[model samples]
Target chain A: MPPPLKAVLADDEKSLCVHLKNLLQQAWPELQICAEARNGVEALEMIEKHHPDIAFLDIKMPGMSGMEVARRAADMCRIVFITAYDQFAVQAFENEAVDYLLKPVEPERLARTIQRLKERFEKRDLDPAPIQAVLKSLQGRLAAAAPPPYLKWIKVPDRQSLRLIAVEEICCFQAQDKYTVVQTEREEFLIRKPIKELVDELDPQTFWQIHRSTIVNAAWIDKISTSLTGSYVLTLKRRPGTFTVSRGYRDRFKSM
Target chain B: MMKTGNKLQTPCDSVRQKDFKPMSPTLRQHRKGLSWKDLGLTALFSTIIAALLTYVFQDESFWVYLIISQGIGLSICTLCRYSLALFNPQTSWGIVAVVATASIFGGMLGGTVGAWLSGIEMPIFLSKKIYTLRVLIMSLLFGSVIAYYFFSRERLSEIRGLLQEERIQRLTSEKHAVQSQLKMLQAQIEPHFLFNTLSNILSLLDSDAARGKTMLRDLTRYLRASLAESRSQWSTLGSEMELVGAYLNIFKIRMDERLQVHIEMDEALKEIPFSPMLIQPLVENAVIHGLDATIEGGTIHIRAEQENGLLRITVADTGQGIASVPSPGLGLANIRERLQALYGGRGRLIITENQPRGVKAVIEVPYATAP
Candidate 1:
């Protein structure tokens, strides 16, 4: 028998994730599923923790996208992307000859993917360079297609009137008590906008999401301190209190 | 009018020429009756030809020979028109042969009969060979010249008819080009939405047959609505709403609980000639750009009303509040262009921020009936 293998799967939809897990189990009973994640962020943590031989990722998720995750963890394992239907993503994958499964994954197509994965995995084809080129091209294509002007200003209630706060002035955003708390130098005001949407609206270069409920401005970071329990806590320049980087977000602070 | 003749002509043969102008068939096999007006035209042309011949030959009785020669000319014309099925006339020489044949037949017949009639005395031309030969040669020259004139007149008219048909064909093609350009302005389908919906249906087909069937039905309706009306530039408000309704139903099933919709339309405005594709694109914009951008999703409200001879439509949404980057065009420009193409400066589409959040697009046009 081939050496035992482990794989982790990630998808935002709970039903779809379960469906894929079931399909994978049926296809290869001996292969073990070490972990499962509901989004791109958790998928990275699971891959890091389990050191799996393969990762099955969904291309779209709320906070972090699968391509972004693949860019970060490409050297760790072979990736088989799951996408409902994305023109640029599919085109890039086709160009790089990468493995991708269309949604409602047919048994026949999945079998083909399995055969390819087993062959490549045995050949020790864990090179991250070519896959990185595909992701870069895909990113360029998506940017050229949308070039979406990211959210620049957010409004929060200020006394009797509404105020438009420049996104740069804001230090952090956290979801609390069914409302989002927008943090600035002189303000910690509440707004109805949720963190789920802020992940998509804010530019990733300037804003880094460190927790499910929190996002911090990269320029406002004061320092990263390690705790005895082996957790990372982020200290900001303007903000008074520190925020604990969650288990899934520790990779952002790993280099530091 | 078909009774008068000279005494030398046998009674039966002269009667045949006078009364039996048989109907003839054209090249296409359609029968043409020999009408009195046709005969009158033949008589008029014969008189003119005879008058010219009289001047040249100095013979008073040449008119009778000209009239008699008309029969031979008419028969030959019918044969030429009908025999095209047997003969190829695309070559220039073939049709000019019609003039040649008519000239030869006209000269020989006119010389034989004209010599007999112009020689009104008791066989004087038979006694003088030079006189008979002179009259025969002169008649041949004059008959050919006269027949060639009529043949050219007929050819000129045929060329004019051909040119007229070519002009009509050019106009029709120009109209077709204009029509196709408008259709190009119609909605271009987004491949992402199409494939995603198809994938969703594939997934649901096994798990929930009933819901899958419902989605299939809605998709069929949506396709029928969109594809059928695309050929036309104007549609009834009621039918356009039906298209929007089918479109919303498909999304409602796919998005499930993430989407909410509210539509309000008056019954009387349904039959008015509204611009096609204006509302559906706006609704699609609201769903894809306004609601789908946010995780929690939101509601799309479509309202149409007719007030004071004006039809007004609004599609509003409560999603990202237009504060987010607008979708690629979102069919906003298309909607505006179609309205302008239809109404000149009288129609308008306006975009504004929805109450507390989202985007609201409105259209106003005169409630004109079908023109």
Candidate 2:
């Protein structure tokens, strides 16, 4: 008979690790758990030491993520990601044909994963192409999972009292030397965050950077016309004056 | 002289005049009615028209012609403004129709008023046997051209405005739908507890039925309470505490002596309105992240209090220090989102290293009675 398969399990939850081991023992009695790790950093060390046939990993762990571990160790062993995210991002993993065990892994599902692993092992197949492709796609989706929620309201000093202005009400943000000016239809206020930071935090679809120092709300834009000087000017619906679209940002108004 | 057509006053002038008397003295300067501006402009135009007519006809009594011109100009300007300001003609065709009709009637009324004020009955002007007939025909043509030109210009901008307004409405609704969907997903009682807890209970059911039964009961209660709160997005601090009790009970059963939980809250402050499932996630973080990592396990303290007009909830675990604040998870992200959605700038979550050992998460929200 073929030698029993050796596997490593890595998860932050100690109770979960114990439960998973018990289930794995029941489902695959011949399987050997050579090492157990409670986080990603230890998982890598254990994988290198044991060189197990398979690695089960929790996607989120303390020092490093499972994705990072898989990237470093996919050549050494097959990877099965254990994830707690059932949000929109899990679909990416499923679409890429990578195996994943959802949090509170069910025995029935774990059995299916073991069955697949056994088939691959019996054939002596160690091709990592599919796994690598899945990892690449997953990297993109994981990066997209949470962009810290945008600024909802900004507190600015009004003439007498601080006025809380809704971010949506802002027509544009113009950068000064040290601070940025938040302009609405009626008045402007100074804020500490730079234009660069605002560009990263604001939803790109709603706000567009038309100049090096100005970010305008797309909804308030009234018209975009080429000036006699051959530069583009953006007029706003409620606010006076126009913003010039610099040569670098001319591509933004190409369709208009 | 025709530039005045673009600067014609609106029907709001009449409405503003009626309500002008009742406004507070302070607002009168900023919110002035347009009647004065229109009146002054009309008088100026009439004087110009009178001078032009006298220079052309060299009439014996220039004063009489000037008075007549003033009456006619005032009537025509007021009539045109009233007709044009009632409703925004959305379509190009509708704008044209309204402008044409208003122009013709305004010219006819002005001619009649002009003749009456000049001491000549309008019947002579309309009799079709005088040179005044030619002048009337000329006025009608000029008025129609000017009104149509002005309104067509206005229509171009109006169409653009409507399209933009429609787009804004559509985008706003789409944004609302997306936000509500995110809220639902964030507030959902996650199934992470389901399969694992059930599996654990399954193992215990055969060996330790009493413990398994207690765990099952607590899990069911926690799920039920969470599901109920998720539907409404809120609950009283008292009920939320009951939910937390059920939750910690399940974990306690799972870990046995490895987990210790201490919950404290004043009875008087229990009825204060609070967001549900918020503190429980932090408590779960304490147990799973802080205590689960330590070999000996440790205590998790859940405390809620009213301090300085704010509701403060703290989850402190005596296991590890801030070294193991698990990478950003959905639970932490959702907690931040729910707080922001509920309280704007007033709600805050603070994480700090507790003295002696472990991590503390403090959540403060505006204190208020149940809605």
TM-score of each prediction: 0.50, 0.54
Off by over 4 Å in 1: A1-22, A30-54, A60-64, A75-77, A84-88, A121-124, A145-256, B1-188, B322-328, B368-371
Q: Write model 1 residue lDDT over A21-59, tens digit each, in one string.
A: 777888987779988887677889999999898899988
- For candidate 2, the lDDT comes to 0.69
lDDT of candidate 1 over B1-371, digit per residue (tens)? 11222222233332333122211111112123444754565556655655665666684566554643444344443443344324434334544664466455554554455456544453664566755554455445444543465457446755863464344334433333344335433453556566566666666676666876887787777776666566555678988888898788878875666789898998887887765577888888788767765556689999998779778898988977544553335645455555655675678776666768887777989877773
The complex in candidate 1 yields a DockQ of: 0.05
True contacts kept of 2: 0.04
* lDDT of every predicted structure (CA atoms): 0.68, 0.69
Alpha-carbon shift of residue A49 in model 1 (angstroms): 7.8
RMSD for each of the candidates: 28.6, 13.8
